[model samples]
Target: MRISLICIGKTDESYLNMGIEKYVNRLKHYVNFTLTIIPDIKNTKNLTQEQQKSKEAEQLLKQINATDTVVLLDERGSIFKSIDFAKYLDKKMISSTQHLVFIIGGPYGFDNSMYDRAQSKLSLSSMTFSHQMIRLFFIEQLYRAYTILRGEPYHHE
Candidate 1:
């Protein structure tokens, strides 16, 4: 199954982008991974936080297929240890998911409809990180999960 990470904004810092790219490239050996960045919403000054999220939600919803399994990277979602996350991924692969889509919403997070459409939600951590930084962290964790699955030495207990 293909894995897609859909985030709302770009990571402007070169270092962060490089780190994200490193994991994305490494992930290719294990799964079909794609990092899709939805363009930032225009004219945020004119919009309320809710409106911005609603707009981002619309764009995010457009990226998924009806058959795709949508998982949101929400702070309030279930948290899992790295090894357990690998097991969780194995479970999804065993279930024959066609495409697994994990989304990182805009600054204000997801809208109600987006939440309503998700099959599950996952939290990288209870501690918060910047949206731009989360891309690197999430991608690295994804790579780590794959390595743990394969018994690679990249991740330590």
Candidate 2:
């Protein structure tokens, strides 16, 4: 199975970009992983929160395929430990899932339409995080999950 992270906006901080890239490179050794950034909406100062989310939703939908499994990184979603995440990924691979997409929405979050299209929702933590920071954290967690699955010493109990 292939895994992709679709997030709104680009990572502007050089430090964060470097860290995100490191994890992405490590993840390539275990699974097909890619991070795609959707451009932020223009003229958002005049638009309402709902309008901004709608624009983001349009962009998000365009990237999706009919067979892709959509999982939203929502604040209220299910949270799992690294080992459990490894097991979840193993199950997806065993089940032959074609493409598993996890989306991180914009500042205002996802619209109702986007929520309707999602197959599942996952929460990295109960605390909130910046979009750029989440990119690094999520990718690192993915790498850790893979290492755990391989019985590597990278992850500790």
Candidate 3:
């Protein structure tokens, strides 16, 4: 299966970018992974939080296809342990999911429309994290999941 991470805005920190790139390179050995960054909304000072999220939703919706199984990275979503997450992904692949899309919404979070379009939601932690930082964290978790699946030494119980 092809796995894609679609996030809003650019990751500006060099350290984060380097980390993300490192995993992105490593992921190639396990799966077809792609990272798509949607540009941040302009002149956000003029718009309400809901308005900005709506606009961001429009762009995010464009990146997804009807056949893709869309999962949102939401605060209220289900939490999984590393092994469980690997099993979850294994099920998706076994089920023959062609494209599995995981989305990280804008600063203000996702709009109602975006939420409605998603098949499921996943939360990395109960603690909050910056959207940029979450990109690296999520990518690393994804790498860890793959390693666990392969019985590699990268992950520990």
Candidate 4:
């Protein structure tokens, strides 16, 4: 299965980009993975929180295909260990999922429509992190999950 991470906006930090790129390259050894960034919304000073989310949601929706299994990265979503997450990916592969799309919403979070469209939700941690920082964190966890699955030394119990 092809795994895609869709996030709203880019990470400006060079250090974070390097870290994220490292895992992205490593992920190729395990599965088909891609990180796609949806450009940030324009002029938000006047828009309400809900309006901003709605605008961002429109961009997010555009990246999705009807066949893709939409998963949201939400703090309130299900939490899993590295092994479990690897198994989760394995199951999706075994089930012949064409494309598994994981989305990281904008600063204001996802809109109700996006929530309704999602097949599942996953949480990296209980504590909140910046949307920019979450990109690196998710990529690292994804790499760790694959390493654990392959019985590599990168992950610990």
Candidate 5:
């Protein structure tokens, strides 16, 4: 199955970009993986939080196909152990999932419409993380999941 990570806005920090790139490259060895960055909304200073999220949702939804299984990276979503995440991915692949799209929303989070479009929600951790930092964290966890699936030494119990 082809896996994609669609997130709003560019990761500004060079270090975070570097880390994200590292895992992204590693991921290419295991699956068809793509990172699509939606441009941030301009002049957010004037828009209300809900308005900003609505605009971001429009951009995000445009990237998704009708056949794609969308998963939102939400704080209130289901949490999983690293090994369990690997198993979950394995099931998707085995079930012939065409495209699995995971989305990271904007700073204020996703709009109601985005939630409606998603098939599931996944939480990386209970603690809040900056959107920029979550990019690196999520990518690294994805890489670790693959390694665990392959029984590689990259992940430790």
Candidate 6:
């Protein structure tokens, strides 16, 4: 199965971008991974939070396919330990039909449509994180998950 991370907006922080790229490169060894960045909504100065979300939702939907299993990184989602995440990754790899898309929404979060499309929701932690930071953090966790699954020494108990 192929895995993709579709995050809204570009990460402006240099450090975060570098970190994300590092993991994206490392992940290639384990699975077919792709990173797609959706442009931020235009003319946001005149729109309400809901309106912005609607616009963002349109872009998010376009990135998806009928066969794709979308997972959103949401605060209310299931929280898993690293080992459990490795098992979850193994499960997805075993059962996924085609592609597994993981989404990181914009600062204001996702619209109703996105929530409806997702097959599941996963939470990294109870604490909140910036969208830019989440890209790096999630990518690292993904890399760690793969290493754990491979029984590599990168992850420690």
Q: Tell me each candidate's TM-score.
A: 0.98, 0.98, 0.99, 0.97, 0.98, 0.97
lDDT of 2 by residue, 14-131 (tens): 9999999899999999999989999989999999999999999999999999899999999988999999999988988899899999999999889999889999999999999999
Per-residue lDDT tens digits for candidate 4, residues 73-151, read 9998999988899999889888999999999999989999899889999999999999989999999998898888788
Better of 1 and 6 by TM-score: 1
lDDT of each: 0.93, 0.94, 0.97, 0.92, 0.95, 0.91
Which ranges of candidate 1 are over 4 A from the true structure? none
Clashes of each: 0, 0, 0, 0, 0, 0
**Candidates in descending lDDT order:** 3, 5, 2, 1, 4, 6
Better of 2 and 3 by lDDT: 3
Give the best candidate by lDDT: 3
Give per-residue CA lDDT, model 6, range 1-157, as digits (tens): 8989999999998988889989999999998999999998889999999999999999999999999999999998999999999899898878755898899998898899999999999999999999989888889999999999989999998
Off by over 4 Å in 3: none
**What clash pairs does model 2 have?**
none
In model 3, residue pairs whose N, Cα or C atoms come closer than 3 Å (at least 3 residues apart or on different chains), thus clashing, are none
Model 1 lDDT tens row, 27-121: 99999999999999999999999999999998998999999999999999999999999999999999998899999999888899999999999
lDDT of 3 by residue, 1-157 (tens): 9999999999999999999999999999999999999999999999999999999999999999999999999999999999999999999999999999999999989999998999999999999999999999999999999999999999987
Q: Please give, for residues 72-139, the per-residue lDDT of candidate 5 as tens digits.
A: 99999999999999999999999999999999999999999999999999999999999999889988
Clashing pairs in 1: none
- Give, for candidate 6, the lowest lDDT window spanning 10 residues: 92-101
